[model samples]
Target: MTTEANSKSEEGHDPFFDHVPERRGTHSLKWDKYQDPYVLPFWVADMDFRSPPEVIEAVKQAGAFGNFGYGKPSPKLVDTVIQRMQERYDWTIEPSWIVWLPGMVCAFNLALRTHGQPGDEVLSAVPVYPPFLTAPANFEQKLVKVPLILDGERWTLDFDALEEAVTARCKTLLFCHPHNPVGTVFTREELQRLADFCLRHDILVCSDEIHCEMILDEDSKHYPLASINPEIADRTITLMAPSKTFNLPGFGCSFAIISNSELRARYKKARAGIVPDPPAMGLTLAEVVYLHGEPWRKRLMNYLRSNRELAYERLNEMPGLQAFRNAATYLTWIDARKLEVENPCRFFEKHGVGLSDGSDFGTPGYLRLNLGCTRSLLEEGLDRMEAAVNSL
Candidate 1:
């Protein structure tokens, strides 16, 4: 038997995540960006784990058929998305509400372009993903950053501050569910307040929910901003993907769900000419992951829970550091202000680990650590972090 076949069908133990693939020469954005053999990159969000077995098998099957041409989304794909949403979130969605796209970042830019006129303002809470910071400027819209208050334990949205910052020129609130970096899954009450704020201001909400499926807390639930009610639904645009959940990001499939006909028409119009359809392989793998990857997803979450615990434990033990114990997402944020360091990102990189610089995410003196890698690598990165912070 071939070595590849052997890797797939090995007996006794699971073969999927047993080894980390050598990604140095693989054109990996995460690996290539650092360019140093010495740096253990925990900066970028992509997982070092292999794509789910179902995804691999489906892509291979599609490639073997050899009919890559102009394509349409499968009815199965739409129905599977509907079924999964209802089953998991108790949220109902119509097939007509789905608009497939190549990436969630595209959805952000589309939302801004479709909703914001020049000089109009777009608001997002700070310490967020980098794309959220830049998307507003891409279309000449004003960007407003409302800081998230750090409660004794977790990050909380300062709704009073958020409401005060809204002005007549503001057109949309670009919200993140299971927020990145800080990883707070906004509670139903928090989301309800957010919904009311938007509805009262008559502002449309574009919620990026890419990490919705990866909630770490078993008790916490992700409520789609639109799923709260019809009033919010008519003004909400939600973006989600299986890429983050099933480690299929490289396959490039994401979608925006817009329930309002006017909003959907605007989004589809903005997407024309510039946005291309997802690759044939992306569609095939997407369908497979949604329908058949749930068992693998459960395994991933259970394993990631351990990694998260190890990270939080280590960070809490160190002096001058307090890691946010997040309820969702594999990413966590740390406040390093107590360390009095000039640059925490560089300090960690100097110790042979790379992390997302907080300043880039609109919060200084804080860093975002990605916990989606192998347990061994997580140990190494954590060790480096401990040594680096201990030195200061």
Candidate 2:
């Protein structure tokens, strides 16, 4: 890296993230999943860094009160969300439009339930987050997968394929913005084209925007798929949260933004009776992060951007591996088809590096590596991967 690039990379890296917490014995899903003590985990979306100090302090304050009870989102948190939309995206929304969910996966199932009948089809581009593939089946609806084509360096939607794939039973499109597995931030032109396509097909769009805040490319910006136009907004249900941005997934808090009252009503009805509200701590942390998490978020993004560059450069150099640059998120998607191995995930685990299997994301012969760890740890994992592939 050039000196200027190096300086830019270190712009806002917080010293706090340097101290990775010891999570092995804490019943962590990522760390404790493997019995081997030397295997480094890079499979899950969970980050190794602690939550923002402000969020931790807020948690402490809540602990002092010592009363854990069922709770609803407060007025302040709702208002903060409203303000965040307007300030960040210039998209204005009313408080009544927010429908809280315990997690984005629940929102996915609810989107299918509210918009489609059993046996209807849910349209989505693969490879995507695993839930998008299974949510349709959970609702007895069929999932129609459209492969995203590799256009140069980035993976993008195939409009022609999408048009050919849509049928009368296709009722909803489960879209992932700043998409998982393969990170690609759709351009405004692309989103506009998608909005037009959905409008033409009379398809409801359930956009998963969980990684909106982690844009790694300086030139890229996130536009809520619903924010494209008033018409699209009416047919769109956008899922967002502070969990991915603030490292608070264990709290289980997320929400859906629905501009159309009728659609919003259907969503709420689908989630009623069974879907539980977010815990009190989740709501409180959300409030604090939205109100005060910007500084920490900026620092964390800087650190992850550096890690992303390192991983991309290093992984692509491996003889049988290919890695693409991510426009957003702390995940790097790698293609390992050429490697002389049957299962890449298990193969790497044997080499002391655990990666998310691409088969789980509807694409075999590929792997998703989490880049959201301390710099030293990321370096160690990359070193292990490099040596493993070199040996092969």
Candidate 3:
């Protein structure tokens, strides 16, 4: 399991060749599910790239030590999380405040089961990740969707509409910070406004900040919703994971920061027997990466920034395609409303590119593209997209 870093180049090397291995026949969601050889799969949020060299090395080191059993997270791993939070977001967190989970999706499901009743309404913004809408349903909770306003090329919340949507039936408000499928790293002001509104209505906020570390814009910063105000902190469940940042989703390691003691108790009570612990290897790698992989992460971020630029320029050139430049995450939300095709993903699949359908994300006539790939694969996907759009 030798790992190599891409040599820094002027125009950037192909990320597909540089980072991602050909994932065919590997049971990879991003690759295996799409059997069409021509369809360049970019549906799942996971990158087509490999994890950082240091991360791979760390995982290898852990694997070399042959001990596989039920394990508790090491104190070092807990400390690593605390340090990363302080360094990255300037948010201080105690070890006791951290509640470990197998995955962020699990955290979402647990949140609904913990706080809301079977028929209580769970609210979230539209054009978000599919799980945000489906999580509530899993627990038989009603889901209330508030559509985000697309003002020009940016997606923003209509606070007035959101206020109208929040009612006695709505007990929880799930937020996607640095929103998935629509790449908007919310401003601090916007976050404050949201916090204020939720506080006034006494609605508990569950924020998923899993993509907090992949921010591409230098001017943009990620603000944890709980850090905005004490009231918000008392009522918020901040979900985060190393999966998205370190490309370790397969490892199944995620945690929630529950600031308020009562809220923590309730969340823990819901998981008294059901929620399984994160894998020992995942915790080991998470600890090692946090301690020694900062330099590698810096280099990776630089590479992703370049990829984001390349995708932005290439997609903008297509006739009926439009993409909003994102602040964080390798996933890019594309506006394909102008296209004549009924199903954008299917249309792209015909052209040898597979994209996540926007309708699944609660926004039709749009598509989401994963930019976490080798430059060659990205270019090929873009070229296919151009040909498809041209033929239209």
**Alpha carbon deviation, residue 58, candidate 2 (Å):** 1.2
After superposition, candidate 3 runs with Cα above 4 Å error? 1-6, 14-19
Worst 10 residues of 2 by lDDT: 1-10
- Report lDDT (Cα) of residue 228, candidate 1: 89
lDDT of 3 at 301: 77
* TM-score of candidate 1 relative to the true fold: 0.94
Computed on alpha carbons, the lDDT of every model, listed in order, comes to: 0.85, 0.91, 0.85
The better candidate by TM-score, 1 or 3, is 3
Local accuracy of candidate 3 as per-residue lDDT tens digits, 84-156: 8888788898999999888998898888888998889999999899989799988888989999988777787
Pairs of residues at least 3 apart in sequence or in different chains that clash in candidate 3: 15-374, 15-375, 16-374
Task: Compose the digit string of candidate 1's lDDT tens values, residues 1-392.
Answer: 12442343222223445466888778888877775678888887888888777776777777788788866679999999999889877889999999999899988899998998989999999989999999888999999999999777889899988988999998989999989989899999988899999989989999999999999899899999888889999999999998898888887889999999999999999999999878777787888888888777876777677778888999989898888877888887888878767888888888888889999899888888888887778888999889887787
Using lDDT as the measure, the top candidate is: 2
* Cα shift from native, residue 145, model 3 (Å): 0.7
Give the local distance difference test score of model 3. Answer: 0.85
Q: After superposition, how far is residue 113 of candidate 3 from its true place, in Å?
A: 0.9
Candidates ranked by lDDT:
2, 1, 3
**Model 3 TM:** 0.96
